[model samples]
Target: MNPPIDDRKEYSNNFLSTNSPIYERFSQHTPRCHRGFDLRVWLNNEKNLTRTTCFCPPSFYGDMCQYQNQRISLTIQFRVLSDSWSTLFAIIVSLIDHSKQRIIHSYEQFTYL
Candidate 1:
């Protein structure tokens, strides 16, 4: 015979419970400032694999930490300031072969405000 199930109790236990303070303190709470930028990069190849993230402080250029993998091709994503007076930016992705210290396949895009 099958055992009886407590539907109400089970439903309550399954629900997720949390407080704002827990999330606020531990998580990135503030909206990113216009001058601040973030970068995420990954490297994958037959020789080696790696992943890196960089946070650029205000008015910085390129990857903040210059994360690189010598044996793999890397993929980079980032935003940067524009040449216009308005608040503009750019986003780019490129495959970098750190073994040779050069870019293999790359796509760059720019936007104006």
Candidate 2:
């Protein structure tokens, strides 16, 4: 069987025309929406302006996404022995239920070297 030819393509801005909007970059800096995206602003032509809506994440809610939802944060730290300096470790941390059977509610794993 004959071998197929392989063609490799390099990325470039040559595909865009000289008059494209990619050249004339706008400098309008919009305010951030805390955790989410696009705080939309509406401005009537000859009337009033400054109407906006902040699209916030599920963890936050407010007119300007200024409120934060309640959450629990946990931090874990580990130390390695001098004898096993080059050893790689897979660490699993779990949350268990209080019962006769050790029911695991949640778990997270971390790789250490």
Candidate 3:
């Protein structure tokens, strides 16, 4: 059962929730994502004719989310001396292949204080 709608939340990522708020948007016949959520709608009035769109996680992509992007996400945390709490950090994160050339598939840069 779903929680009462009158309840408000400070923040909600319904897509990531077990008792998702978005469930109210789908029909009883709608299918689960199998690690990805499937957004489906009937094409025309045919019960057998339906279109599906997958809302995949960062590690995946594709029509039904059946394929992997061959990349892993990473998270990092750091602590500095109390005096340096406000110091800025210049960080670069990358995904590199293990082959001889060490190919860089993608990267991200972060500059924050």
* Candidate closest to the true structure, highest TM-score: 3
Q: How accurate is candidate 2 locally (lDDT)?
A: 0.70
* TM-score of candidate 1 on Cα atoms, chains taken together: 0.21
| Candidates ranked, most accurate by lDDT first | 3, 2, 1
Lowest-lDDT window of 10 residues in candidate 1?
Answer: 63-72
How far residue 112's Cα lies from its native spot in candidate 2, in Å, is 50
> Model 1 over residues 1-111: C-alpha lDDT tens digits?
644578767776656445556655667555332334444345767757765555655344444433333343556555545664565455555566577658676565656
Model 3 ranges with Cα > 4 A deviation: 1-60, 64-66, 69-73
> lDDT winner among the candidates?
3
Which consecutive 10 residues in model 2 have the weakest lDDT in total?
A: 2-11
Please report, in order, the local distance difference test score of every candidate based on alpha carbons. 0.53, 0.70, 0.73
Model 2 stretches with alpha carbons more than 4 Å out: 1-11, 16-31, 46-50, 71-113
Candidate 3 lDDT by residue in tens digits, 6-70:
54342354335655556555535545565588777788775578887779987777776777867
